[model samples]
Target chain A: MSVTLINLFAVPNGKEDEFVKLWEAIKVDITKQPGFISGKFHKSLKPDSRFNFINVAVWENEEIYWKAFEKSAAPMKEKLHQMGVEMTPALFNVLFEY
Target chain B: MSVTLINLFAVPNGKEDEFVKLWEAIKVDITKQPGFISGKFHKSLKPDSRFNFINVAVWENEEIYWKAFEKSAAPMKEKLHQMGVEMTPALFNVLFEY
Candidate 1:
């Protein structure tokens, strides 16, 4: 089944711009990967929200999602870490919709 | 602008079904509220994910979202708490999409 990757990022207050720039750079490469369906990068309205940035992306399936992640996004972890942006990512399936 | 409500649910192990049941009950009323747009309930693929369930819902705007929440979903919070389900909900705007 197709999987949705929900990645929540805890970006330090002053690092929001840096985080967005890095994400834009990563997006350029990841979007071209196999099985990538669509994606939306969201910024929380409240500055103090625990996870200030959230990415909701869809992949064809779990295998392709992980493969693409390893190839394109995994290498960018060091830079994200340097920016003090922590990420909590997980794959999910749609349980219900309306 | 339209806002997305991303509510992450940390449901205790073994309470998945009960959590979902409560969510469905809330959904029926909330979906009928004014300004409701769309919603998707997602279940994490990994059993050990920190947030087992996530609800991504769109509303006409933040004001409408809060209004609907106060009218329909707020009352159910006690039940959710009793079920050992913790929620972290935040409103977000789409910064980028592809």
Candidate 2:
């Protein structure tokens, strides 16, 4: 089954632009990976939201999703850490929709 | 502009079914409200995920979203509290897509 990777990022207040730039750079590579289907990066309208940025991406399945992540995102761990960006990522199945 | 309402839910381990039932019940009313565009309820494939369930919904705009929430969800606050479901909701704009 296709899996949705929902990653919520707690980006520091002043590092929004930096975070986006890094995300865009990562996206360029990740989207070309084997199972990538689609993705959307969202910025919270409310500045005070605990998680200011969220990335929702669809991959063919769990294995492909992890493979893509390891290739595209794992290397950038240090950079993200330096920016003080905390990420909460997980694979989800669409339980219901409308 | 259309706004995405992404609400992450930290539901107790064994109460997953009960939580879904309540969410479905809320969906029945919320979907009929003006400006309601689309919605998806996602259940994490990993049971250990910090947020086990997420509700991603789109509305015409922030104003309409808050109004709909007040009308459809505010009343169920007590029930959700009893279920020990914690929610983190925020309205977001599409920053980029692919």
Candidate 3:
């Protein structure tokens, strides 16, 4: 089973666009990792709430995700925080098969 | 770039577990897609609201994702719904990477 991660975030009011821009800046480097399939970023349609942004990723497994997290996510995580982004990421191991 | 998809669902009453169970049931078949990596699913910590479930998936791209959707997701989607899973899956093409 492939494990997918969903991270919910609050983009500190007006800083949402900046958060997206920053992600745009570093995307290429992150995609270079092995076992990375692809990922998408989404913001809540209703912008009135503080919980506005979401980041999702597909990887080969925990190993690949952790490796990429060290080399890619660490710096970006810091940058996002500096830009006022707050989030909680939770992981789910695939236990279901259709 | 990679695209990750997060689907938030309002699991009717106690059906959250069933929803997750159903997803688990079909996850393996879904991962067979060519561009597949891995994915995870998470539910809200506060389950007071009916909006208590989340499904996350990472794919190779829109093309691969769509292919998987056609071959694997259609049936699982129906099963999920039959088990009372209601969700909105929005995708954001990768706009950032670090």
Query: What lDDT score is found at residue B15 in candidate 3?
Result: 75
Structural similarity to truth (TM-score) of each candidate: 0.98, 0.97, 0.55
* Candidate 1 residue-wise lDDT, A1-98, digit = tens: 89999999999999999888888988899889999999999999999999999999999999998899888776788888888888999999999997
Q: Can you list the residue pairs that collide in candidate 1?
A: none
Per-prediction DockQ scores?
A: 0.94, 0.92, 0.14
User: Across residues B1-98, which tens digit of lDDT does each residue of candidate 2 receive?
Assistant: 99999999999989999999988988899889999999999999989899999999999988998898888787788898998989899999999998
Chain A TM-scores for all candidates read 0.96, 0.96, 0.85
lDDT of 3 by residue, B1-98 (tens): 46666676777877766776676666667666788776665655456543466766677777777777778767767777777667667654444443
Which regions of candidate 1 are displaced past 4 Å?
none
Task: In model 1, state the lDDT of residue B74.
Answer: 61
lDDT of 3 by residue, A3-78 (tens): 5666777788788778777767666776788878777667654565445777667677777777878887788888
Order of candidate numbers by DockQ, starting with the best: 1, 2, 3
CAPRI-wise, candidate 2 is: high
The C-alpha stretches of model 3 lying farther than 4 A from their native spots are A94-98, B1-53, B56-98
Each model's lDDT: 0.92, 0.92, 0.67
As for candidate 2, its clashing pairs are none
TM-score of 1: 0.98
